[model samples]
Target: MGKWMRSAIQRQKQFYIQQLMQSGLVNDHERLEQWTMAELRREYERFNPAYNAEGGSRHGQTSPRTGEAHH
Candidate 1:
């Protein structure tokens, strides 16, 4: 990758790293540094409230508490 591309990726990774750390999903910065950007993003999104806010209906599943699909 070019210098700019690498710099961008590093910045994006830093964002995810901070998010993951704040979410308590990651404790070791060294291990996080070894992760690919895609991996970091996936982990961050997994715990991100907005990413999960779409609810189960959109994902083709029913809610466990109500046994009803979200709308």
Candidate 2:
């Protein structure tokens, strides 16, 4: 029970951190460099919510849907 509770709390914290990252609360190279591996993982998870880094599915792709690539 204790383990489960701890896990739940950790999950909740991760969720909020992901939300912040997705919302652009944390941006720029400096901020990225300051984050720990776990925090970066959570941020990446949020950015790539569908876990698809490749140009495959419609989801998880951060680029614009339009074919034109921004400079």
Candidate 3:
């Protein structure tokens, strides 16, 4: 996930979103610096609650990701 997720799309939009991010169309450069796979998984959860980052939940908001890293 990114720091400021100003926008979120459905899972079907993943491909287009990635293309936009990589092409600078998303405009979240700062987020890229501190981005992590774990965070990405969390964002995925917002789309699919059953989604798991590490085979389990990070307790919704207790993870370090809930700090200033959020948008």
Candidate 4:
């Protein structure tokens, strides 16, 4: 029950974040400010297990690197 709900919410958040990223509203995305862009990325990392500043999984760590020992 809780797991399913969380999964749905995570999916929705991922979709919205993707849309924002692809919207091109942020000029010079490569150099986005730490506050705005970084915060958003942090929120994303909360629900995305495989996210990283450089993208994708790294050393089997969680997106937030919570040290939970992801498989």
Candidate 5:
């Protein structure tokens, strides 16, 4: 059980690291690997355009059918 949990956590970290790299947030693999999962998630969300300042999805602000911001 412990091994499986550890593996899952590792996978999540790697996933976030890959996303950060793809988003041009981090350039060094070694440095990224040194960061904790929480740090990785924080940084990832900080750069995510869909998230508002309160960390809520911005989708609600847009009209579902038109895909335009609600005025």
Candidate 6:
């Protein structure tokens, strides 16, 4: 793969690991060893409020004066 592609892949892996840690899936060495990328992604998406459209109401709601949402 190209350098940029490799870098992106590495960054994505790092992001997944961080998300897994935050989700309380991989607590330590043993859990980390047993965790899979698919499982991590699923859990992260499940717990992520941004993934739910209803949960995004705060972002979509606009300020009357500014006529803009926080995004």
| Index of the highest-TM-score prediction | 1
Rank by TM-score, highest first.
Answer: 1, 5, 6, 2, 4, 3
lDDT of 4 by residue, 1-71 (tens): 69999898666655545644564433343333233445556545544544544565444544342335443
Looking at model 5, the pairs that clash are: none
RMSD of each: 7.7, 9.6, 11.6, 13.3, 10.2, 12.6
User: Candidate 4: lDDT of 9?
Assistant: 61
Local accuracy of candidate 1 as per-residue lDDT tens digits, 1-71: 89999999899999999998887756898888888888787666555677777532245344332254533
lDDT of 5 at 28: 87
lDDT, candidate 3, residue 45?
50
Report the C-alpha lDDT of model 5 over 17-58, residue by residue, as the tens digit: 999789775788888898888878766665677654566654
| Overall lDDT per candidate, in order of appearance | 0.71, 0.51, 0.44, 0.48, 0.72, 0.56
* Candidate 2 local lDDT, 1-71, one digit each (tens): 69999898667665655565566745454555555556555445535545545633444433322233222
The parts of candidate 3 lying over 4 Å away from their true place are 1-30, 48-71
Q: How high is the lDDT of residue 21 in model 4? A: 56
Better of 1 and 2 by TM-score: 1
* Predicted candidate 3 versus true structure: per-residue lDDT over 1-71, tens digit per residue: 66345344333345434643654423564553355545554554533434444445343444344353321
* lDDT tens readout by residue for model 6, 3-61: 99989866766677687577664556345445555655554554466774555434444
- Say what the RMSD of model 6 is: 12.6
Off by over 4 Å in 2: 28-71
- Deviation in angstroms for 56 in model 4? 38
As a TM-score, model 5 comes out at 0.70
Order of candidate numbers by lDDT, starting with the best: 5, 1, 6, 2, 4, 3
Clashes of each: 0, 0, 2, 0, 0, 0
